[model samples]
Target: MKNDRGNSSGSKSWGMMALFLITGAVLGGILGEFAANSSFLTGVAPYLVKQFPIFDLPPVTVNLYVIKFVLGFALYPNLMSILGIIAAIVLFRRF
Candidate 1:
């Protein structure tokens, strides 16, 4: 019975973890931007602010004479974003 309860909650926990990770990445990116502009951290700003594209889905267009639909996806993870993901995992585990 205890094992069954754990399994059921695991799915929800995974969802929450993803949410936290995304939130952390966004917040960290914003912070990274500010840090990049600050004079005090100029030495390390360049490294932290650099962005590398992990994946980029070419835009696909569907035209039907009257309208068109475009779809695409991309992932560019910077150093700060990676840090954010790690921080998010740590925070989630702590809670």
Candidate 2:
């Protein structure tokens, strides 16, 4: 086996960390939206109904809209980033 100085363990660690960060961000957004009583389905449900003229349901409440925006746009993104960085540090330390 040739000793490849070009392929350092740190590079692998960083790559793994980046992957974790991305996943964390996505999960955080989803979870935050859920916690805030937001629905990915509901958000687009009205538009679909309008376009297709099916499921004649009322518009989503303002409270839900507020919650969803807060969670999906504000809280989740920041939390995810923080969590991702922490996770990366922990994982890197282990390796």
Candidate 3:
């Protein structure tokens, strides 16, 4: 009975970790898309402009689609999984 309980608890933890990872991937992809498309970084652009005052300050171009693709395909999933593992380890240690 104790062994069965442990197995069930472990499975539950795994399921929760999977859910967390999926959520993180979706959020990261959305953020990457926003980062790529929006001129939201314009405020920071001036700082770079100041650093290179002599050169013409061209606007920073982020390709939202490319960012979306990369994050969706490569980055987000991996990053989320790693983060989830780290979090699980930390929480387990604390407990």
Candidate of highest lDDT: 1
| Each candidate structure's count of clashing pairs | 0, 0, 0
Better of 1 and 3 by TM-score: 1
Query: lDDT per model, in order?
Result: 0.87, 0.49, 0.46
Tens-digit per-residue lDDT, 1-95, candidate 1: 23564755434377888999998898889889999999999999999989999999999999999999999999997889889989998998776
Instruction: State the lDDT of candidate 3 residue by residue for 1-95, as single tens digits.
Output: 23564654434466656665566545544544454455986554333222112234445555787573222222323333344445655555453
Superposed by TM-score, candidate 1 places the C-alpha of residue 2 at a distance from the truth, in angstroms, of 8.2
Looking at model 3, residue 14 earns an lDDT score of: 60
Task: Return the candidate ranking by lDDT, descending.
Answer: 1, 2, 3
TM-score between candidate 3 and the true structure: 0.34
Per-candidate TM-score against the hidden true structure: 0.82, 0.36, 0.34
Candidate 2 lDDT: 0.49
Could you tell me the lDDT of residue 35 within candidate 2?
41
**Superposed model 3: Cα runs more than 4 Å off:** 1-12, 42-95
Give candidate 3's error at residue 91 in angstroms. Answer: 9.6
